[model samples]
Target: MLKVLNAGNETLYNNVSFNIKGQEIYANSLILICAAPYFEEIFVESSTNFNQTYNDIEPDSFRVFLRWLYGESLSQAMQNYEKEENRDIFFQICKDLLLASSKFNISTIKELIEYKLVTYIHDDLVYDNLEKVIELANEYELDDLFKYCEGLKDVIKDEADEPENSNIRVTKNNSRPSIINNLKLRFFKFRFFLKTRTEPGHKFKVIN
Candidate 1:
């Protein structure tokens, strides 16, 4: 099982080397080719001489990719970095994974990252966060995610544009009160009229 040969057990099955950030990471050539077609060109059939330096991608992102390639569930693999302290780094890794998956042409990782990013939407969703995700969605051709983020951006924009005094009633001449507020105002007026009516036969007519 690929899971048994993961991480620290590098000496067990590794045949190809990747130099990421001056750190040497090793993996099985067969596994890489089988997992992503991008590696098929790098490692020829049964050839052992393979070493590549990757300067564009972060080491953490590459590690996550390898773990997924080595039979780890994407969710389970991300659990280690899901802490509050690691939240920022984890988000960056997910973003990097999108690029890495794109370069490798791996749809599974891309789909998982899309779903993971979508989970970020909520009542407290931030505009900047949504903006970044939306940009990534468009760049990566994630149409569904792009649409969702675009809609959420509009919703958040509308909410931000709302007046701070939105809950406060406007002047009667300026605007109509909300239904509940109108009903409460009518009840208060009727109560005042009744109170006045009891005073010395006061002629208080309840006007509609």
Candidate 2:
């Protein structure tokens, strides 16, 4: 059986602290090292500081990753976000988690996120979200998912080229844009994440 840790509610044996964008999150070093072995280097016995800071990652996304680290089902966490009726937040979290997983060498989470994202795109071909996914897939070298998104792009092109669908209604979120006749699709700005560890005693820090 998995021993699940209640994130902020846990008091016992929570030795490491992650200060992300002024928010303090506590976790067990053992759990983190077990999930991602490279963390073992960051949480060394010689290191006096137990706090890690990250400006690049969102607190919500870090919490989602921690939940999975502490044995919560990823699907359940995603479902909770989906029930909130704000799918943008849900997808954003997935995107962030995918990046974090890749950085931490957590292949399981990375693969799961890729599958989830592609599945979501398949279900709903939202224009903006699809474009973002395409960028991530291409940048991250996710060849298969990138190819799938390219196919979706062709579908979008076909729909956009249709004169009858030129006046599709635009929503408040602008998720569905006007047909390709007048719509100009632009790629999202690229973001870079950097992690630095200058010395042995210094804790790891992520800078955007």
Best-fitting candidate, scored by lDDT: 1
Q: Kindly list the per-residue Cα lDDT of model 1 for residues 1-208, writing each as its tens digit.
A: 4454455335767767889888788788777776667787778853665887888778888887787776667766688877657767777888889988777777656666766676543312566667788888899898867877676555545544677634432222333334335434443554354344333221212111
TM-score of each: 0.71, 0.72
Clashing pairs in 2: none
Which regions in candidate 2 have their CA more than 4 angstroms from the true location? 1-4, 7-10, 167-208
Tens digit of per-residue lDDT, candidate 2, span 89-199: 878788788878777766556555666666556445567778888888877777766766676677667775788666433333345444322232311110010012112
Q: Which stretches of candidate 1 lie over 4 Å from their true place?
A: 1-12, 45-49, 121-124, 165-208
lDDT of residue 163 for candidate 2 = 82
